[model samples]
Target: MSSPALLPLCLLLLGLAAPVLAEEAPTPAPETPAAPAAVAPALERSQEQQQALMRQLPAEQQKTLQAGDESFLALLMPAARAKAAGTVVLVPGDGESADWPNVVAPVRQQLPTFGWQTISLSLPDPYDPVVAIEQDTAPADTDAQANSEQAAPPVTGGSGTAPAAPTQAEAGSGEPAQAAVAPVDPEAAANAQATRVLARIAAGIDLALQQGASPIVLVGHGTGAYWAARYLAEKEPAEVKQLVLIDAREPQGMPPRLDATMGKTDLQIADLVHAPGAAAQRRKERAAQKANKGYRQIDLPVIPGDRAAEQEQTVRRLRAWLDRLPPAASGSPAAS
Candidate 1:
């Protein structure tokens, strides 16, 4: 039944299909062994704006701005040694950059009395997260178990333990405490703000090391608080002991990322917002706190008076919370 022409035909069919098979197989990209060289960017130096900013400030304030990127970069380093008994980094709310110099003095004034050194840095690029995630990890060779052990406070008094706040309520059956869980858009401002806050956290760690403080804390307001939450959820390591959120704003639609990201054992989160809606949020947070374990959420009522009265009440509550925090922990929230 075999025919020479039939065999030849079969061979022809095979040859015809081979090209199609080869075409379907993807070709791998060429691998380069070396890193590409970095290109120097074109400068858009704003001489007029730069001159104006420099001229308007006092000598010290001007000096801080002119510290230059290169020099400032030199200020940051490995902060593994900057363990408990660390420094605090204070951040303001969004569109609140102008208050930095003014706020810094008061925070600095208050912290040293409680044995915390403070670092004040201006994080202008709060939207780019490519470099700033330094606040959470231990030294590259850090002993994680050791770092944690270092932060645990010694039992020194009669009760020998602080009162723990109850956890927040569970999902569906309960109210949303922090933020409603949702998908995060990679390009959203909240994400970018988180990136910037991460950088500030790193900067704060560097400041702590330079000031000879080891453990670190982050005191954030409004958007800064959102960033703090992000840092804790995404990057906070055992070294970041606490977070302090002052007048923290709306959840800003960043939840799912925070849901699995925040670890209660590593960082303590405290809230101090005074809006009318805070009452509802406070209840949900209290329930969440009770359910979560090892966390507390404090909601101080806004003062019913003029600016002076408001500031006075806020300061008093802040002082009380500060008293609750263990001395020299990272800038994560812990009342007392």
Candidate 2:
């Protein structure tokens, strides 16, 4: 039985005590879930390497060419002579760049001096499931390490060590924790790569046409040769007059064999084979079987440990073959 004035003071004291009690016992915060792991794309490594190479190339030669929804870098070199002979579009194979040191770079660079403009295209990576999986798993591994560190419990008491993280079984989950990665489809991947490559070639050809470069010639090295021949067989563009293949090779797991594609195309072809290559011999036989009068095989002596000499030899042969060609026909852009 307190007095009325004392009653108000007692209520005020209780109000203050309520906050103090709450401070003494706080509500635990909700635990945050771990972040999902990062998954690397199949093309990530190739694209990164291409970007690095792009930086090293001359700024004036750089050209951004669009193919479908994607845009890739190319190098456009104008002919050195006042009167252009023709435009040679160069395509490089897998694990190679537009300025590849071997056939692609030497031919692209040297051909210009002989009055031929050159356009070099960058190709997509060939699909390799094992390589793709290994490359993609690296990012996941790094993300897992970060996740483990972040999910670890804070240090407690005298031990000064963080408490062990709860295993899936310890947390009452029967299944093991895993980062899920989307599966890549092989056929779909191949089709996508083919589409991109063909689009790029078409774009390059269109560029050559706009610049009024006549008698377009497609030059391919390694697997790049396969794509060039395929383009000729499939598209059958009226502008292209000749084809050059340097150590032609078909990409593994892709359709339409190189020899088979070459047989289907009706353009003049020069098959430059580095000696001792059995594959080139087989390709020559197949072309002969098809009775392709326009096809001819030229042997290049392999100069081991002397790449410069080999490239020079190749360039000299190429120059002679090109010089032998009859000048562009009457209606050609060069004549116009």
Candidate 3:
């Protein structure tokens, strides 16, 4: 009934009202699922335990070295004699502190008595959750198999015919077969860890150089030996004149085993192995010796009850070996 001239004004009013109506309309709220439960950080727990142990170390002997953003704990034992022959940088194996209970701590504390300064390092833990999770799930699969066997009727003898192959659906559904399951690669994580460890070792070596410890020696116990040998072979540092490995063993998932590293390097190497059950290690060392003329292999007797005597014998043998090597150039500092 409105006039034609009012039509344009009416359309404009309706257009403006459309937005207002929309603004008044309520929108349905988005659904959010419940939050996940909190889980404790395993790495933090391990660090806390190490920190507690570090705090208990002697105030004078305990020292911290910066490696990237993280600070590593080190224990320094001065030589007992007036003039130190040379400094020995000790690297402990996995889950071992600067002053580990076994070979690491004993060597560090006792070597000082023989006129050699010792610096021991605390290394990272070897625990890998990816590997552990795979191992834990294995038991559950075994239990399921046992249940299936018990549920089936017992047969006096096995049938001549073989069981039928699994269907596509059966194979794909539920938990996958052990052989079908693809294990998570821990190589990246392990490489990162190795890098961090090497940084710490370099820092320790720098400190020793600053202290004027010439003709420096790198001593590694257990898997620590692998790290030490690898460092010398890879870096080819001139300051480190000798490499000593005590019961050296390669770490799992690490490339270029102990023997491979030893064989490639031309540095003065003393490969010490604990007798009995060390046949493989001995054979590897012998092979390396053929390639490296400077290599020397020493077989150490393991005394079960007399640990003190065993360590003394070890120190004596190490001292004799060091005495045979040419002394550092007179008036030459290690840093140079």
Against the true structure, whose lDDT is highest? 2
Q: What is candidate 2's CA lDDT for residue 322?
A: 74
Write down the RMSD of all candidates, one decimal each: 23.6, 11.3, 15.4
Model 2 segments more than 4 A misplaced? 1-43, 129-184, 329-336
- Model 1, 1-336: lDDT tens per residue? 479779989999999999999999999999877966899885223323334445665444332322223222111112233333356666655544423433333554455554555554444433322222232222332333334334445545586776333232222324223432343344465555555556665655555545555456667766666666666666655556677766665344444433234443345666665763643355345537547543556666655656555655555665566556665443433422
> Each candidate's lDDT (Cα)?
0.51, 0.80, 0.74
Candidate 1 clash figure, as a count: 40
Q: Higher TM-score: candidate 2 or 3?
A: 2
Candidate 1 regions exceeding 4 Å error are: 1-86, 98-105, 113-115, 125-193, 250-266, 276-291, 327-336
Q: Model 3's lDDT to the true fold?
A: 0.74
Write down the TM-score of every candidate. Answer: 0.49, 0.73, 0.67
What TM-score quantifies how close candidate 3 is to the native fold?
A: 0.67
Error at 223, model 2, angstroms? 0.5
Where model 3 places Cα greater than 4 Å from the true spot, the runs are: 1-40, 43-49, 127-184, 276-291, 329-336
